[model samples]
Target: MRAVIATEPGGPEVLTVTEIADPEIGPGEVLLDVAAAGLNRADLLQRQGFYPPPPGASDVIGMECSGTVAAVGPDVTGWSVGDQACALLAGGGYAERVAVPAGQLMPVPDGVDLVTAAAIPEVAATVWSNVFMVAGLQPQETLLVHGGAGGIGSFAIQLAHQLGSRVVTTAGSADKLAACTALGADVAINYRDQDFVEVVAEQTDGGVDVILDNMGAKYLDRNIDALRTQGRLVIIGMQGGTKAELDINKLLRKRGAVIATNLRGRPVEEKSAICASVVQHVWPLVAEGLVQPIVGRSFPLAEAGAAHAYMESGDHSGKILLTV
Candidate 1:
């Protein structure tokens, strides 16, 4: 199999294409002939040696992929050869083939191409788990999504809108904000020029019922202040700093729930459950054209280094993908 290997950690240049042996399948696993791989922010960190694959996982860096089932492993059932699916991997997605636990495989929805479907798993799971499951965004309430033009935020806006919630999003530029608006955000504010807190307060009557934050510590204080009474805040990334002082008084006064989570390190069964839930609850939305996976761009699998650089450039709105 041809794969992108990160033998040494450094810059994007460290990612190089090479021919490698195919992965061995284990019990309950399925072998996939890779079609497209989703490029994520964590891929950049992994390539730079800041984030290593989980212990005993493949050293390769990629989290999600879409493809055709080539073979089934011992004890795996219900899935047949030639199934069209995508899987979330602990490692090894930047390759021509991957062995994924059958439970981790999700069928691509009707009307979505295999390449565009590659963009679905990770960000969809992340946004649904963070904004809906964790934060419990309710209808008739206000939900704030940060980095609204990005993959997760774009999905967040659409999902919130579908649930009858008013979606507010913050981005860095006018074009990005427009993307969010097109995704069904009720209010889109440019973080580069406006204070999102002020914008939220003005637009939502007071504050939002939920906040999906990526800035972490940098937005913590303001996030608390921007929440409505009994609101919820879910943080999935720390694009800014990691540590920030919290105001317990504000939290208590608002009866807010602040939670932080990451999906990658979760146990297999848990991830499997989330994947199942997605295949059930969200795939229909995709098929119905209510929620579309936004694919920003694609690069050859061998050019993964360049792909990571492009993602880090923050010049694109939506998911960056790699064609295998």
Candidate 2:
């Protein structure tokens, strides 16, 4: 099998694809002949030596992929050889073959192609678990998503909008803002010029009911200010830095709740539950064409390094993929 690994903890230049032994499946796992893999911000962090895979996980740097099942291990059922599925993984997605816990597999939605299905798992699981399950976003409520042009944000915008939540999002450029609006954002703020806190306030009656934030500490203070009474703020990434002061008095006044979560380090049972929920709740929207996989571009699997460089350039929208 050919797999991608960082030669050293450094930049995109450190990534290299080389021959590696095919992974062996464990009980309750399935071996997939991967068709494509999804590139994520966390992959970049891992390449740069910041984020390591969870204990006992494969060191390869990908988090999600779409593929056909080549074999199933003992104790696994409901899946068989030749089944087409997309999966959530802790690691090893950047390879020709990956062994996945059967519980992490999801059927490809009715209208998505194999390569495109590679782009859906991570973003869908992240957005669905965080925005709907964790924060409990409801119909008629308002939601705000940061980095609206990126994978998670883009899916969040569409899902929230389709589910009847008024969506507000922030992007860096006019074209990106337009794209977000087209995806169902009621208001798209250009983060480079506008104050999102103010725009969110003006768009909603007072503040948003929920905020799906990835900018961590940089947005902490303002995120609190932008919350409606009893609002929930779910922080899933620290793109803007990790530490900041929080105004407890203000949060107390609004009775808001702040939750910080990570999807990759979860136990298999938990991941399985999230995958099940997404298949049940989100896949139908995709099947109905109410939500779609948004893929910006793809590179051959051997060009994983270049793919990393492109994602770091911050010029692409939606998900980037590596086709096997």
Candidate 3:
């Protein structure tokens, strides 16, 4: 097997592809010959030595992939050799082969190709679990999304729109905002020159009902200010920095709740449940073409360093993929 390894975490230049031992499956696991893998911001963090894989996880730098089942491990059922599947991996999707728990394997949606399917699991699960399941965004509610041109934000905009919620999103430029609007955002604000909090408040007649945030502490105070009474704010990224003061008084006055979550470190049982929910709810939307993979660009597996560079440059929208 060949996988990407960070040769002393620092920059994209630190990443290199090298021969590695093949993975073996355990009970209830499946062995996959990876077709493609998705690139995410977390991958950049891992390369910089800010994030490390969970104990016993593959040190390889990918979190989701599409592949064909090569073999199923002991006690696995309902999947067979040659089945087309996409998996939410703890790590190791950057390799040619990976061992995934059967519970994390989802059949490729009817309308999607195998390579594109690699872009779905991580963003879909993150959006569905955070906005729908955890935040409890309801139809007719207004949802605010930060970084709307990126993978999770693009998916969140579409899914919220399709589910009957009014969507408001902020991006860095007019072109990015336009792209967000094309994906069904009801209101797109250019964060570089606009006040998203005010825009969301005016558009929603006070504030938004749910906010999917990636900027973390940099936007915390303003995020709380943008929320309506009883609103939910789910923070999934920390690109902005980790430490910030919270106004407990303001949160209490609005009766709002804050949640911080990460998909990578969760237990297998919890991940399995989230995967099942996505297969049930999100897969149908995708199969019907109501939602689709938003692949911004792809790189051959060997050029993963370039892929990381592109993503870090913030010059691309949606998911970047590595073709295995």
Off by over 4 Å in 2: none
- Between candidates 2 and 3, the one scoring higher on lDDT is 2
Model 1 TM-score relative to the real fold: 0.98
TM-score of 3: 0.99
- Which RMSD does model 2 reach against the true structure? 0.6
Clashing pairs in 3: none
Candidate 1 residue spans exceeding 4 A from truth: none
lDDT by residue (132-207, candidate 3, tens digit) is: 9999999999999999999999999999999999999999988899999999999999988899888876788889
Which candidate tops lDDT?
A: 2
Error of 1 at 59 (Å): 1.4
> What residue pairs are clashing in model 2?
none
**Model 1: per-residue Cα lDDT over 1-324, one tens digit each:** 899998798888888999989999989899999999998878887888888887767777889999999999999888999989989888889999998888889999999999888999998888777777777777899899899999888888998898799998988888898889888998999888899889887887779998998889999999998999999999888888899999998899998899999888888898898888888878889899999999989999988888988998999899999998
* Model 3 alpha-carbon miss at residue 261, Å: 0.8
Tens digits of per-residue lDDT for model 2, 1-324: 999999999988899999999999989999999999999999999999999999989999999999999999999999999999999999999999999999999999999999999999999999999999999999999999999999999999999999999999999999999999999999999999999988877778989999999989999999999999999999999989999998899999999999999999999999999999999999999999999989999999989999999999999999999999
Every model: Cα RMSD to truth: 1.1, 0.6, 0.6
